[model samples]
Target: MKKAVLASALSWALLAGCSQPAQTDQTIHQVNSVTNSSSVSDQTTLTAAQYSEQFIAELWQLYPEYALYVGYYDYDDQLPIANPQRRAQELAWLQQQQATISQLLETDLTDHQRTDLSLMANFVKRGIWQIESFKSWQWDPSEYNVAGGFAQIVNGNYKPEIERLRTILKRLEHVPAYYQAAQANVSKPAIPQTRLAIQQNQGVASVLGDELLAKAIASDMTEAEKIQFEQRLSDAQLAVATYIDFLTELLPEVEGADPVYRLGDTVYEQKFAFDIQSQLTAKQLYERALADQKMIHGKMAELTTELWSTYFADQAMPAEPMAAIGQMLERLSQVHAKPAEFKAAVEQQIPELIAFIKANDLMTLDDDKPLVIRHTPEYMRGYAVASIQAPGPYDAKANTYYNVMPLDGMPAEQAESFLREYNQYLMQVLNIHEAIPGHYTQLVYANKSPSLIKSIIRNGAMIEGWAVFAERMMLEAGYGDFEPELWLMYYKWNLRVVTNTILDYSIQVLGMEQEQAMDLMVNQAFQQQAEAAGKWRRATLSQVQLTSYYAGFSDILVLRDKAKQAWGEDYSIKRFNETFLSYGNAPVPVIAELMLK
Candidate 1:
């Protein structure tokens, strides 16, 4: 389930932008041209490099936040134009890029160069579509927007930048305008009999009122800044109030008596495909998930028997497998670290991982951007257990922060249990995923890539896929002192995969209630009751996010095999990794097309 969630989260984000662009001939041409050009490119000459670099620079300006997140900060203080007029202008810019890239494709370029061009062009077309058609601004109700706003303000431990703070203020000022626009544009076609409009409304308000508004006003700004911020706050409040009023007025206009807005099967299918990026029908995906779930269950059963016979030969078997697992977890938890301890662990492991990479002659690390690991703050805890906060676009120094949440406020017994769950082996798993040969390593190369478009459409599947792949790689390379516990950790990671697949299908397809999903999580995945409940809530809030890990890992494995088959004896692990990372994190199909060519 954990694996599935990780996979789904990554894929969900990618697919979110899939159906955004209204299909127009021009748009289709733009998308096709880029994809076709890349399908043929083969050369790596100076001219190709120049063209790629130039195109990336132009592309970066289209999505400022993405640019900033990727360490490009030329227009740090500026926000993407959200108004209809501005969107039209941005769309025009995309059209120009597409035309230019298409022209470039007509040049006498090598297959590799053409491939790179197609990749970049596809990126431009996608970006244009998302910006112009998706109306992400209209769907301001997404948790991502709220979470992004929170991350900017108080990632809790880190200080918010003045520019970021200013952007937040601006966004707040425009909230009322945003909501009004959404109200005007939003169409409520069908209402679900079991819709939780009230809960969603409350959730939206809490995020806006308590998290966004309160946090913004509480910031210690300069006198002038404060006044400006307050004005924006007033405007946002007014907008939200108006939105509530609009909702009330439209309540009677709804076609159905149910609180839930029924998106209908067609719309739901569109959303599902857009997010998953696969041609697989919903029924197909659901069946695949069920089959995968059963297979994982069998693997767990086999492992249980093997571990019990090998490791616990002297002791009597526990009544439940979870009891034995719990004992092992307890032993592992003894290796807990406070902030200082956590830092020390990082200090010890990072250099070793670096040395291993260098010794193994893996891809070269960028001396310019060093990776750093740190503890997560309280505020950001709710969103992620840990993450790699990518560097801003303008910032040359790229640091990947490995956030280890502190166990400061818990009761002694609870703290012990938590620590047991996060022992050394678990930490190593995280380190490999977030740091060396994982996100940090992959992203460093991605940051330096020539294609700006790939960076913008950065798929989470690729990101998590690489991390999960890296774990397996390390194991194959004899990591974790060749201990069974390390292998156990790998299996535990699959817990996410299993849980994600089951819950996604159960909730979205099988129509399993949240309570039932929670029960499955606790029983099958060994998640604590509270954690299981939270997982159920998250599943409802985020559909298909859990499937990304398994799906991504599966795709990556296929990619690896294809690369090996194509290169044969010429293939080197390091070279393949570098080549893969060079494209940045693109969709698997796109990446496969580029690599195979």
Candidate 2:
């Protein structure tokens, strides 16, 4: 629940491509006169590079917070509100920039520049104007509170920055005002069940009330500041508590209402297009996912036979899906007797994983910035099966958190069974994705990229794609020393990808029932009964997000194969990976246009 605004400058870098070829003196002069005469310095004509630079600089001034997130330290304290005035101003700016880019496109530029302009124009339209008009206050208080509050606490403990914390506290103090403003300006549409509002409300109360308030009161601040912090904390706590109460009380009343507050088909299509820059419909993507599942299942069946023959030579492989899944779950549980033992094993394995990546040169190791894994906080734990929280804005140091929930409110046998399902090999697969050459590595490089613009528009497709790709890479790299159990773990990870895609389409597009989805999870993915039940709930709450990993990995593979074909003997794995990640976390299409050039 770390609230971070998209970085403006970094996003531009990722979006910018090579400019068009040199324009004739006449064309340059004509464009300069229509745009900005001042831009026509000693040079008679404006190059695409020069125009891109000027355009980005203007955008940075408009959205400085974006710059901060992208590693630009110049605008550390700025917060851009999505208010009416700001929205109007942003729209005006986008229109102006669009015109400017359009004028440049009319001139003679390289093919790369034309593609870059197309992306930039689309980016401005979708991101700036669309988001502005669609602004909802719900985003400010609820999402902002939980994301901002937890970020402060987590980072504050690791490295205390009193000034920044105070700024965040001031923001928290105004939460009521923001919420009130949102109520006044926007319609308080029925809360979407798909959103984690209930869980978020609970999280805000836990972190802001217990953790943040406790820290603020304990700090040696001026008496006035201490009192202000205490009062603000109290107000935040009440706001969150009341919201939770309201939601619970209204739940039964609204039970007959649509569970999902959808934007419907058209809006969903727009969002999909903006996110991936693809024309593929939801139906098309669903078919692809199903096809992939079928192919992978066939491969997994063969591999499972080999593994059972190797490990349990005397015993026949479990034929029933439930029995097979149960056996694996039992084996997983036997590995960790207690939480302490589990943590210790994780701690020992992380460094070894890091070392493996370094020795293989899969990615550059930031030894100066190590990753830290911990359990999910009590409040936010409900929404996520697992998550990774990046380092804060003020802190350059990188810390990666792995949040695993311990089974509670269940029978002892049930709890043990649940924990076993997430045993050693599962942990390793998670580690590869959350740490090592996955998120940690890619994020570090992204943070350090020269283009601040690329960092702000952080694409989930790239980040998740790299992690999913890394899981395959690790197995191929002889991770677990080619052990068949580990290979089974890899297939389990694949199952997650396949199930996510299926659930997204089934529930969101095909209108599949909850019970049917659960059945599919158990039968097709071999998910444990308890796990399948929980996943059904999660699928209802979060749609399409889970598909990002596999969707991204598919794109990455396409790009990788294209690179191999193009580079031939010149291709090097390290160079290809480095180049692929250099574009920041842009979508696959943007990455292709940026790097393939």
Candidate 3:
């Protein structure tokens, strides 16, 4: 990022807002006498901008890994400390910050400052709630895993090789402390989350000791320095391996592994408030998701019938389109990329998606921004098909990694099933959602926002929603020259988003059975068996996250249509896209207010 600019603005605003009284009037009565009764009230109060900057600085101190990822090098040697003491300190700090923010005078602030106050105050409160209220850090072992420390340092070219390795070695030296804290803090473990943590830690440890070290060795460093690095890496590997062992031993004794991963009704709602940042309650969202599921199914039925007549004209097919929808979906799945070609197929779709976005004038595209499609890191696989790891606001100029899972060397049947599930049509939709105008475009604008607070505390729903929205936007713009196959695939993929909300809410709150959830994915959503199975595991691993796609997409569509109606002839898709993204992934409602007014 252009740090000189961010620093100058941040330093000026924050210094004004957060500066302490120059001297605390220690000996006021000794020499100087106040002429008026209220003359001694000169304590410095931070402006909203300063408060926001202070919050970011303090947050980086607490979670240094984030600072590093966002291109802040000051605290790169440290990672998050998740022990009880750190949690308590974080909780107390948030409590103080929250109180300080509440007491600020709105009349003294600018429009941006007021919004900054709201965003940062909420950020502090959410931090407090996560530590004190919901307390997933208590059971979620994955939350405590500091396994990606080295990979983070080596993943990009944010700094010089020697400097990056210095930080890596500093962090590596603290590995024992990091895991020891995790071991001490995670008193209760969720079975699935724990198992996955252990499994991934093994991979993470290997990467840190072997893959990461090998990569770092290729960097510019002295032989003596290399030996020092190798020793530190070994120690770090031991730390992670020990953590995995601890989890493995604790797996049997830990409770809450019952296939049901729901956070009950009350907790789920509170999480929804934080995670979704929406006015709708869990019950209301569930009802909407159910309605959407049915609606999307109806749409799929129409598309499937059309596909069947075109692709299977002579075959003996069921008369009812609903009955034949499954068959048509299967036919579509048959056109998938081969196991080895899945990654290549995704890469090939990028230029096409970019072209479509440009042709439609959907939004301004930054051709100079860095984006690379690479294999998903070992430490983060088995969670999802693909992800867009956008550079943090601080690292705005760095690459946005599109991590796609590769199917190399997998068992033939598993690879084939995975390929069949993604297929070509859905891959196109997925590419649009992850690259082109989805997260990549939205996040770029976020980094450019004047207030760093917005990008720092981005709404998950907004980010996911834009990607989901992008998929629909592309389809509506006649992508693939208005191909029915594109529409059919888009509709089916849309079903995945809709069903995602239902599946997550059902499993997490309704205690929906694994079998029932799988049925919903495979039968209702038209997902392949492999795809359905992966989703079930993901739903087990997460709550409220899956809901973001549907919740966010639906809300964004509503806002866009509302804008269209309000603006009429002045309305343009390009304007809506640019304007909506300019708010830097704030909550949809917040953005709605900004756009509307």
Best by lDDT: 3
Cα lDDT tens digits for candidate 2, 1-597: 111111111132123210000000111222333344343222335677776666666555555433433334343333443345444455555666666677777889875566556656777766563444433233222232334333534354443556655755655564554333333333453444413556655655555666666667677666788788888767767766655565555445545434544344565555555554544665576678889887777666666666565556778778864455445544533665354455556667888897787777776677887666666665555455566655522355745555555544557766655556567777788777777678777777776665544554556666777888888987887778988777876787787777787786677666777678877887777666667767776655544555667678888888888888888898877778888877666677777766776
Judge candidate 2 at residue 303 and give its lDDT: 62
Candidate 2 vs candidate 3: the lDDT winner is: 3
lDDT of 3 by residue, 433-518 (tens): 88878877887888887768777676778888888998888888888777877787788888888888888888877788888988
Full-model lDDT, candidate 1: 0.55
Cα displacement (angstroms), candidate 2, residue 34, comes to 21
Which model scores highest in TM-score? 3
Sort the candidates on TM-score, descending order: 3, 2, 1
What is the alpha-carbon RMSD of candidate 2 to the true structure? 7.7
Candidate 2 error regions (>4 Å) = 1-122, 128-150, 153-160, 182-195, 210-220, 253-258, 262-264, 310-341, 392-395, 406-414
After superposition on all CA atoms, what RMSD does each candidate show versus the true structure?
8.0, 7.7, 7.8
Model 1 spans > 4 angstroms off: 1-62, 80-140, 143-303, 309-314, 318-349, 359-363, 374-381, 392-396, 406-420
* TM-score against native, each model: 0.69, 0.80, 0.89
lDDT of 3: 0.70
What TM-score does candidate 1 reach? 0.69
